[model samples]
Target chain A: MSEAGVSTLEIRDLRVAVEGKEILSGVDLTVPKGEVHALMGPNGAGKTSLGYAVMGHPKYQVTGGDIIWAGQSVLGKPPEERSRLGLFLSLQYPTAIPGVTTTNFLRAALKGQGKELPAREFLKLIRSEVAALKMDQSFMSRYINDNFSGGEKKRMEIVQMAILKPEMAILDETDSGLDVDALRTVADGVNRVRGDGMGILIITHYQRILDYITPDRVHVMAAGRIIASGGSEVVAQIEESGYDPMLRQAGIEAEAAASAAV
Target chain B: MSELISLRPMTRDDAPLAELPGGDPDFLHKLRTAAAAAYRESPWPSSSRDEDWRRTPQIDKLDPASFAAPGSSATELPEYLARVLEGPLAAIGASHTVVTDQAGNVPTAGGSPRGLAVPLEEGLRQDPERWSALLGTIAHPGLRKFVALNTARLTGGALVRVKRGQTAESPVRLVHGVDQRSAAFPRTAVLVEEGASLTLVEEWVSPEGDDSLLAPVVEVQLERGAHLTHVVHQRCGSRTVVQSTVRVKLARDAHYDLRWALLGGAWQKTYFDVEMLGEGSESRASGLCIGRSQQHFDVQTLQDHIAGGAISDLLYRVAVAERSRSIFAGLIRVEEGAQKTNAYVQNRNLLLSPQAKADSNPTLEILANDVRCTHGSTAGRIDDDQLFYCESRGVNREQARRLVVEGFFADVVDAFPQGAVREAARSWVLEALDELALSGALAAGYGSA
Candidate 1:
């Protein structure tokens, strides 16, 4: 965190590798508090790796460059500690924890961020958030996404993001595999929680979610680094064309080794 | 019992005249004498030689003489034993405990209306005939060396008998614990008469202390149409080696449900032998064992279908972390004339650390036609993907693992018939996980944010 404790994530030429193959190569991006940016990219553009890399997933190595949070380098910080620093990652696929209820997990997650609420108050807040996301109350007691359907898992991820209320949340394909109804509900929940000193980076290949919770800025990722950056207009352009224009314009140098998957 | 009273450190010669523990019964005394002779001639069980002990923790030595028992008094009892029994899981309303004072010759705890729970010595004194018929009748000695040892040297014992047509609303809890560094043998005999039903929880524990050996034996008899819900929880000290035997018999239309939860102990050997002797009888057994550090666990189970149309299902789960190890070998034996018998056995082991090891063998022996029998087993470690998912939520890596491990055991905990027992198991598993985290055994699981 910065000396003044301001919320700002500055990624300067960050290079990340997973199992000897680099995913994010010399990438630069900046997310100031209270701003939502869209990271538009295709399936193999290393978008999820960037999100995990930002969250400090151990499997992802920051072989080069630096990820500055506020003013401190958070390259070596563990996920939970970095979470306490107000960073969050909403995974594309939220896993099932057989015996751990969503309510208990959310409570523990919030506590890790140093936010302890009375039981009654916490219950009230969770209930309100669950209702706001159009989720059934029973989901609170069910195992963490154990048997949740595709759409339900996406909504659950958003619900967690709402409860944790981190300063910055990296949404990794929260829009994929979601129906129109689910997309609307997830976008509604994200919009409700965002714009309150919380910065968000929504990673997706399509402009479907952009049609709901509009992003202030859009960046196209090709190969490993950002090839194009612009305002919301980039979203319309990407929708009109696709990653093909960006992928074609930015030729692959192949500086990093390839042919491996994490 | 005279020869066993105040016997110094156990010795090979003490095998002879190792009669009934509570008191001298001519019938049991004769059987004990024969077991003594058998113990001398029985081959020393080895993991390499005996299939039942194949995966059992290697015992470099057996020194019954090196064991010690606590002095006879509540004052002399260790505080940890008291905390373990009375603290987390307070004694239930219908609870039983043998007072160690006066050589544990007294049944200090109360019992239920339909049941009579008393110390074996006190029971024998009050009704020798009844005690004689109930004790040492089902779990015969000399079947195994440890069983023979327990049958021969048991110092403290208790018996519970549920009358006919009685259904108990609350569990009859029993606390078997010790606070010394001696080989303590606890023997229990339970009889559920025809049409009687009750929930029984037997907890055996030994807190932090010097190296010790504890060998407990239990025999349960379920009469025709009887229903018994039995749960066993064992948590021994790190230096202790525990060898326990459980034998159960189910009569016509009887229902037996058994659940076990185990933790700790340097080396643990537990065997549950169940026999369905009557038609239409049914039994379900489930167990959960969590081992940390360099602890080793060897659990062997057997389901014998002696009569036709009986059903038996058994499942055991083990979670080992650090350099701990777990071994499971279970068999479902359908004897001749046991046609149409249905039996299923399964074992699942979770290895939390790379060094942690597990071996499982769920076998079936069908000697009759038209019988349905099957066995399945799986051994694995925590999914790194799941670990990463939990860590992204702000739970520290260790905390994340703690959640996943507890989740792994949640199914069994939730399956308990009683809400109180379910809650207790859940919290106890979490407490054990927290303790592991404190000891830094789960340090390797700390997930990078």
Candidate 2:
């Protein structure tokens, strides 16, 4: 509603397509600095597509609308440029890069951001962060997510998020494979790194993670459009009754919209 | 041995076959004479006809006679060669170091008991019986045209022998350097006696921009219960052409390990032949080659299991950029009675550019039903998902590609034996990547940042 602020990630009438198939029809959302927003949707609701589009993935083409960050449309910008502009996307399925150590990759990422630190200092930072995540010290020397457990891979993503310390973070399914203990650790890691100046966008389908990371605002999407946005009460509403009640309230056919989203 | 021989330019017609060095023993002269006859009899390999030479073109254009033999071995060491001797090779702390260049065979540093390390001519002169018995046994001139040429023109060669039941604490290095318009032939003979173990590094290098030819041959014989580690490093100038071969034979219970690093030269072809001749013998071979520009690198390997209960494993990797090309061909053969033999060969190639080309062919022949033999070959470009993963972490596309390329070599380089050698190779690989970037090949081939 308000003009996009300098420190906010504003998606206005955003339309995205993948392989000529339109996924996100008209998604509008805004996450200003110092706020945590949760995007809840059923399977194939275009939530992951929105996260990738915001990160400037080459495959997720923007058909219309704009993704304005810092008061500038980030259209046509390459993924690396957007990353350097303080945007982070925690992939749902992070690919393994063999022969690349976690420390070396993280150091390169930091150097790319012009935050190069001395060798000893960088190791110290990595050691402390890895320890904070309750990961083994040997994890720093192992290849990036190579042969890592499911929980370890999820923690590795959070580690990158913490080390890069981006201005805005979009976590896609960070709680999907995590157990109770791992979910708590990951939630604590997020809370620790989510400073006042950093904006957070958590994309999840369930209400369990919401209990750990209470969101300032919650939005629900169906058929590529955000149907509802309000305080945390929206979460309770969805928890009490399934999306059918919400679809009924919104005058949209639940099955048709759900399958179309698929 | 310290007195350098005055180098004289000789064409193919005047190759000194008639006037074999008078001071040499009868066996030495006979070997040379026989090799000379073989050189004249065999013709250069043709890519169209020889399956092993199919990937290598312009074989007829290489005139070994056009380039003069390495000049007076008295020439001062170049800055680069001197730095190498003082750096990684020096850090290896060799038991004996021999530098063969225009300056001749210079014993730069180190020593071994009972004259374990000496010039090839001196070694043959000292114990003609032992030298003659080992020479031509593995890398005989009749094997190939280039081998014959190397044997006929062999100069500035070195011999490293570890006596029986002795274990050398450090390695022996035979470093060879060539000048522009000059050819170098360095022959190395390694003999590890029964119960003895040693490490040998044979290196060939030249200054940048030198259009030269370097043909080297190495023969290794490991006696029963002996162990040996061999490294053949070739980093010649970009304009130089290289043809090299290493032949190794293991006796009963003997072990042989080889690491061949091919990082330079404009056009290069190399061969590795390993024979496990006795029960309980084992051989392992691994190498890496990084090519840029229009350079062509072809490597062939043979693993022959002659005795039952022997094992041989080979792994070779190549990364090519620009219009460069690389080919890896490997074969594993098990004899009829070699029932318990186990052999494996794998070749992996990374194409860093659309124009860059790589070919891998790994074949196996098993005559023994009880033998286990497997071969695999792979050639591919960097995965798009991998690239995107790095890019999303704030690394630019170019840097991301570089990281992926470096990671591609990390496993191979880490497998190098000595710590110094491994570190040196890691730095050189990084340096090669930097050179590729500076030449605009990375930007031109890989997408721009």
Candidate 3:
């Protein structure tokens, strides 16, 4: 793959497997600095698995390719190490850590990133973020994702993303369970953190979020591979024709190439 | 009161008894009789190959022969308990009361309207029949050997009683202060009449120079429609040894809330046994313990659901540092025919140092199929993610860890009764954290990246 522009993340022929089953076979993606890319796919298309594999989740094994972040191979690094390297993942279902308050959890994450802000500064940052997200001030004292509503939890993920200020972020299905108002609010939070130095890969099954935060590039993933890649029109096509036409095109192209090789 | 009985002389064999003053006629007689009986009947718990005592060799380490009763005139009690009693008394429009010098002395000042606090020996002499009857009714003879020993040889303790339908707006603080170089057995019996509400704070402390052993027993009974909040703060000196047992019974529609703070003591073992004996009774028991240096603390709890439709929830958390060790063993038992009972027991521990160890065993035995009962025990080091999350925000490793540990124990601490008692516990926990930081137990830049 050619390294053009400020490519913060480069996924080359990335293949991942879970429980002896291959997913994301030979998938290639790149998120250059100051750019937003949306990976849109149908249900069970391994869009979430790609985010997990890139973030170095232990369960998602990279069976074939390499994930390069900031010109360095990050395949062997653990999640915390990758986080230190300025990588963040907005999980669709954030794990609830009982007895850990949201403020305390965010503070730890910030400290781990080697940006240990002073208490006053940290509280200021969190208060501003919470207000920007329209979260109740009392939410700071609540346990991390414990007994939180779906929208509240999603907003918390955005709050974490903003506070951590990661160089690259992989948001996996962040818009799945949100209402229109909540979706807009979350998108606004995401947009506030978007800029020239940050790259965001928004993985979604619906095109609602794309309307709020437009993507420069959209890729359609099917059957563990990126079958089609194009500009923002690809999302509109997927929204219109659904995955059947693209599945047919991918199958035809694979069969033709196989027969020609034979 | 009976005449004081003097022992033969102060010998190494009779050292334990010599710790108590040779005065107080009634207390002396009770001590000699109980000590003689304990020496003759109950042999020292065998440390040889006994399964329960094998790892914790009870007899090998303790020289029971040399253990003695504590003295009468020792240093003043810790200021925390003092402030607790003084603040509430003034809040509820009570006059300044004279603080007692010894645990047995009753404070002589403005009279408390709702409850009565009397020394155990005084209560026994003033009304032996009533005191003996109440003691016999509550103290079971077979199960707890320590309670039996305490009952037989008990000296000075508090007898707090709340009259029927009377609700004391202020909490009654019972400060049991032990003297230097003495072993004190303080027995407290609390009785709440029907429709009465009372809050009792039992603060156990040893004098500064005291290396005494405090073996106290507290028995509480709540009548129908009664409400009681019991807070036990065990803040003895580092050289002090304390083994306390609290047994509570709740009647119909009675509620009991207990918050224990185990912040001090060289070796402390507390057994909290609660029984929901009447239908619709509720009990909440939560505690926070901090063990450092060579301290070893163990808390054994049992929530027995003997009646139907009773609810009980318990949460206990401990933070261990240095060579300290903590063990929490909790059991939730729902008896047969006790239907619709809800009970949950959870214990979480944070191990700050590699050498610091924590053992938790939470068990549930449900005989009634309709009952909902669950118990869980978790022991883990501080989460790397949590630590990193704190550090990345500019909190040094120490402060970040302190916050995580504070959060870990906040679940229990927050449940403490709202007042000075809660504040005292909170400050004590923070002090322990500061000590942990000063000792360099928290490593620098420890969170992974």
lDDT measured at residue B239 in model 1 versus the true structure, 0 to 100: 86
lDDT (Cα, tens digit) per residue for candidate 2, span B256-278: 98887888888998889988899
Output candidate 2 Cα RMSD: 3.3
Worst ten in a row by lDDT for model 1 chain B:
B99-108
Q: Between 1 and 3, whose lDDT is larger?
A: 1
Runs in model 1 with CA error above 4 Å? A1-6, A252-262, B1-10, B19-22, B57-60, B68-85, B95-115, B125-134, B178-181, B337-341, B368-374, B417-419, B446-449
Choose the strongest candidate by lDDT: 2
Candidate 3 local lDDT, B1-449, one digit each (tens) = 22233344333233223222333344445544555445445544454854333334443565433445333443543464355455422343322122232334434445442226565555555566555556635544334546555554455666677789998777776666555566666777788989999878777776556576777888888999899998888877888777778999999999999999898888876889989999999999998899989888878899999999999999998888888989788899999999999999999888887788898888998899898888888887887656544443334567667877887787787888776667766777888889888888776344321
Ranking 1 against 2 by lDDT, winner: 2
**What DockQ would candidate 1 receive versus the native complex?**
0.59
Candidate 1, clashing residue pairs?
Answer: A78-B449, A79-B448, A79-B449, B67-B182, B67-B183, B68-B181, B68-B182, B68-B183, B397-B447
Q: Give the candidates in order of DockQ, highest first.
A: 2, 1, 3
The reply for model 2, stretches above 4 Å from the true place, is A1-4, A245-262, B1-23, B69-71, B78-80, B102-114, B444-449
Tell me the tens digit of each residue's lDDT in model 3 across A17-67.
Answer: 877778777998888867899997766778878887887766678999899
What candidate 3 keeps of the native contacts, as a fraction, is 0.20
Model 1 vs. true fold: TM: 0.91
Is candidate 2 or 3 superior in TM-score?
2
